[model samples]
Target chain A: MTENRRYRLTAIAVTLPTLMSATAFEAGASEPGLPQLDIATWPSQLFWLVVLFGVGYLVMAKMVTPRIGAVLEKRRQTLDGDLEKARTASSDAAKTRAEYESDLEKARNNAAEFAKQAAMEATKKAEAADAKVARKLADKVASAEAALAKAKTEALANLNDVAAEAAIDAVAALAGIKTTSSQASKTASSIATKLAKQGAN
Target chain B: MSNSEGMHSPVAQFEIKPLVELSLGGYDVSFTNSSLFMLLAIGVSSIFLISAMRRADMVPGRMQGMAEMIYEFVAEMVRSNVGSEGRPYFPFIFTLFVFLLFGNMLGLIPYSYTFTSQIIVTFAMAAFVFVGVTIIALYKHGLHFFSFFVPAGAPKVLIPFLIVIEVISYFVRPVSLSVRLFANMLAGHTMLKVFAGLAVMISGAGGLAMAGSLLPFVALIGLTGLEVLVAALQAYVFTILTCMYLNDALHLH
Candidate 1:
């Protein structure tokens, strides 16, 4: 719409000047054989200017301006496209960098966690194995101690029985050497006493 | 003629008189020498560039190479200032630059009218730029385009005053812009003509004065070269200013 207005304006400008010249020529009336104009007026010049301006403006607006505008628009579009492409590329790079950094952070945290868990598990296994070996040693020591006590008790009982049997055998041998009952008794008593005394001594 | 004929003075001849007498209506609309040269400049540039571009190849011929160079130059200029967004303005700016450059150069031809020497013509061109740039600004920013005059960091107390100043500045742009080109071209050409006229007068006086005439002749030649550079420079300045205005329209700065 604005372009159309300009077309009209240009046509008027051109035609107005044409009319002005026409008026000038008419006024130079003294020249013989000169071509003449039928009308001469300010209003007419104004009208002609409008007409010319309109025609010129339309021609320029329709034909000349468009071609120039198209070329300009193409250049503008190319620049805009470049800027947009740069912006997208920059954002994509930033996104990739953020993703990489986060992934690296997660990987690091996982490694640390796994190490701590593995160390805890190893400590628990070591402590269990130590407890198990200590309990086995305690059991073996208790059994050995019990066997020693039993051997000591059996040795003492054996000593007591052998001493009693020796004494009985000595008494029997003294009796087999005989006499009168009283005499034998007395002698035996005496021998027994003596033996007793020797034993005592 | 004689040294007393001041009309022959290079500076005096640039005095402007409107070619067509302003009136309400007439049937005598026709091209004057100024209009003829103006059309010629546009035609020459268009023909050269369009024909040169017809057989564009990877390895360009001379004409194609020159055309490509111009395209590249303007494209780069737009790209740097207006950025890629301003690429659309390259064709307009390029056409404007070539047309003005050719017009300025062609006016130096003997008996040719210097269109740029006339304030009205230069002002007309400048006004067109001003109007076009304003339209672009309004199209891009709508009514909010007025905010450009406020600036971003200015103190609030100064807003009303600053807006007025900015508006004034905006309106005065075409005047200043037109005068810059018109003044430069007019000054350079007038000086050259005056110096050449001196050389003619001095040589006519004869004897030792003829040797003095060589000085103005030499000065004229040197000034002619300088004028060529100035011509190209003015075209460049004009083109760059247009781009800057477009940039302002696009970015509102």
Candidate 2:
């Protein structure tokens, strides 16, 4: 295609000068007449037209058009590049946001787990303290009951001895008969044993 | 006074006094005012484009902006009318547009010659376009290009008549194209000159004539502004028609 274009351009370029010369020859041979209507000026006018038009065409095709096309092309490319960059940047931002949200979710899960473990440990410690306080109160109650039982037994024995002595004095005063101390003691002991048995029942 | 007076004739403005008369063989190829303005149009177009594109920045300034607008305008016309196949011919079309545009506008200036106003000049350009398009059609499509004259979906009875009409219209392209530009410029400039002359003749009488000249003077001013618009419009019309012709040549239908 380029070769064809070049060939055509060269052909046109070659023909232009030839055309101009041919017209110039016609102009020289003709007589001057009415400026516009005259056949003489036609050749010259046509000649200059070819020359000037050829010059204009060469400048336009070779120089002006390409530069303008380039400018337009550059603008389009720059716009496309900027749009691509923006798309990539937005995608990157979206990825970063996703990662951040996932990290936050992970941190929240860890915090919940730690709180549950701490609560369990605190409940265990409180239960252990309550058991120790209950055991101490039970031991104190048992010892006090033992001391009360021992004192009751000792008071019962003293009461029986005193009862025997009193019974012997009463018999001497009322009946004028004196009983033996051992026999009085034996009687009092029997009475005391019976009372104790009744209390047990 | 006669010599000075002779210069004021309306028709005299169209005279082609030779600036540098030259000959080759028996040919008289003299450079004249017409040639001077043609060169001026060429020089101005070149300079305008070269300077506008010299910077060639992605962001265009005023001059570059103007140049680009014109470029894009013609480009769009070619693209819409002629399609992508017309790409190769863009430079030629663009050059023709700017040349004619400048030629018309320059003619609007006082004492400046409008080369496009000349029948031969406009005809030359139009003939070039017509011949070039026909050649392109012939080269691209070969002898089948002649089928362009046959109307599609026509009844068998009408085909012959239609073909004849189409061929005549095709041959008339250059004539019509040339006459359109030539006649518009010629008529507009001539009208402006006549109106200005009327104003001048009326004012030259002094006294009451000077007061009476006001209407013609105003009309002259209005006509001058209208001429400028017509000049630009005619150039646009010429270029667009050329593009349409190129399209028909390339695409057939």
Candidate 3:
């Protein structure tokens, strides 16, 4: 619709000059309304206006516009790069967190297992030490008992010899007896009985 | 001529005549008020900005702050439309916006010429934009820039007609663009001047009619405010169109 309006407008504007021309020829026509196109007079002005516009345009489009577009493009790239970096960093951090958590769990489990093993080994060593000490003590006690038994046997033999000597002396001194076998036998019996009585007393 | 001469009254009785007329090689060169003001506009703009920028500090004073604000405003405009890709063109766009803004504002000063009021000046600027965009489109797209004349999804059989319409529209770009800024400035300023003149004339009559003059006085105040808005709008329109042209050059769409 706008395009059609513009077209109609253009047609009217173009036909205007021609219509004015005919109207002019019909009028007094003393003064020419439109001046003849004088290339020398006005085209120079138009030319310079164009030249100025061109220079201005070049400055804007070539120099100015491109710089602005560049800044925008650079900004876009920077933002994109920053976003990617953030994403990668986040993913890396997540992976590291997961690895650390798993390693920590593994370390805790290993520590618990090691502690249990150490405790069991300590208990076994303690038990072995107790058994060795008990064996040594039993051996010493048995040796001490054997020594006591030997000492007792020697003491008894000494006591019997002393008793027999004393009896022989007493008989010989009391009866002026000869050292005869029968006398000796009787004396031995008496002595044996006396010794038994003494032992009893 | 009678209509124009009669229209000159109710404003200033003063008229500008060429002073120090010198026809240099058959070109009528005269230092008229218009020429003087054109030079004055250039000088004033240069002096103010240069002086303001002279003692530019990281922390700005009033003058520097104003200058910086102008720079920032134009910079933001370029940034928004052209995107960061358009940063380098900041100077041209900035200059165009500033010159037009200053010209429009300066005319609002008592007894100052409005250069933008003249079609020639406005058209010159628009022509510059039109030519610049064309060159840019061509340079960027090469022969492919011609493809801009063809609309997308346009049927093949209708191609020729669309091309003609496109060409005409393209040619009209500068005319419409230039006239919009020029016509708005001229019309608004002229209306203000006429109303103010009426207010002065009516109050001079000095009666109940003079009491009635306060209405125009109030309207003048209102119009002044509107003119400021229009001035800014004109500058904005000029800058945005430049951006749009730049957009076409870059995108070829």
Candidate 4:
């Protein structure tokens, strides 16, 4: 404990003189009161302030201000110009869009017209082809009927001959009364003509 | 960082210690701590503005952005407060704003003097503004400027009374302007020093008593932050008040 106390004493002894000197050096200003209240210093403060403030004002007014003002002005002009260009470009784009839309509308209408025309043309062609087929079918039916009438006439002429021969043979064999072939053929022909007329009716 | 001499008084920090002695026309114009800080304010602000605008790009960089922001801020203040007729005075107002801003801000640094804390400095600036605004009013309106004092809508009997009140209010502009800034700076700095000294004194007691110093230290921190706000707020107030005065001068009513 004694050794510890002696060590502290030696340390304090070493630092005390230096600390005292530092304290003396650190004393407040020569005039004890508030430096601001001291009127004597006002002259210097005002003078230096005026000098510095004047210089600052001159530098700012003459040099600093105009330069900054120019930059700001130039920036503003550039911005306004860019905005104007954008506006014009947008309007031009709108005009182009309108024109394109109109053109598209016209093209759509034209396409519909063309499609209608093509469809009508196709319908007409089909109608013409249908009429031509109908006409050909009618002609073929008329020709076919004419051939049938001619065949019927020929068949009747044969039937009359055959019937007249049979009738002459029957009369000669059965009743001993022989009829002439021409008269029999004439009778058979009249019967065949009447039958054909009845069948047509 | 001060020793036994200043430890007795918190106001010791405000003492003007002469670094170099100077004289002019039988007057003591010694360059002191206050003058040095004023010089610092002027030099630093000028240099910051100049350097920031050195590359005044249309697309401004950070420093240029700050400089332009301040420029536009003051420009807008003058424009809004005083109108287009105030264009000629923009440069002066701009300088005044920046000067006070820097003075208030620079004084926040440890061991640096706050020149704006001085009554004489703030008074000088306020008086200058008052006189200049008066001169502008007179120049613009001639003798008719006296009409500004008389209440327009009041009775004729109250005219003289109203004029007296108006004149008193008008003259109080400089006093109120200077004192507002001076008192704010002086009070804030004194409070900060007092708390700091309290903390130091408490801690100097040694042992368990040193723990009590924490309270004062925390208060000091809080006060410092408040002081920073006051510094900026005071600068803005001074500049804006100047603008309002200019507005009154330009438009008498």
Q: Of the candidates shown, which would achieve the greatest lDDT relative to the real structure?
A: 4
Residue-by-residue lDDT tens digits, candidate 1, B1-253: 1134333434334432335543334443333455556667766666676576555444568986676666667777788778878866666676677667888888877667666665556666688889999999999999999998886788999989999999999888887787788777766776787788788888988898899999999999899899989888888888788888889989998
Once superposed on the true structure, which residue ranges of model 3 sit more than 4 Å away at CA?
A1-201, B1-22, B55-65, B79-89, B139-142, B207-211
Deviating ranges (above 4 Å) for candidate 4: A1-32, A108-201, B1-8
The DockQ values of the predictions, listed in order, are: 0.01, 0.24, 0.05, 0.24
- Model 2 / residue B133 / CA error / Å: 1.9
True contacts kept of 3: 0.00
Query: What is the lDDT, from 0 to 100, of the residue B239 in candidate 2?
Result: 92
Question: What docking grade does candidate 2 earn?
Answer: acceptable
Query: Alpha carbon lDDT of residue A6, candidate 1?
Result: 46
Each prediction's number of clashing residue pairs = 27, 6, 4, 0
- TM-score for all models, in order of appearance: 0.54, 0.77, 0.59, 0.73
Q: What interface RMSD does every candidate have?
A: 10.5, 8.6, 9.8, 6.8
Alpha carbon lDDT of each predicted model: 0.66, 0.79, 0.66, 0.85
- Flag the better candidate by DockQ, 1 or 3: 3
Clashing pairs in 4: none
lDDT by residue for model 4 (B84-183), tens: 9989999999889888999999999988999998878999999999999999999999999999999789999999899999999999999889988987
- Report the lDDT tens digits of candidate 1 across residue range A1-201: 133444444443543232342223223233211111111221323333334334433433444435434444565687889899999999999999999999999999999999999999999999999999999998899998899888877875554455444545555576653333444344555665677699999
- Please tell me how candidate 4 rates in CAPRI terms: acceptable
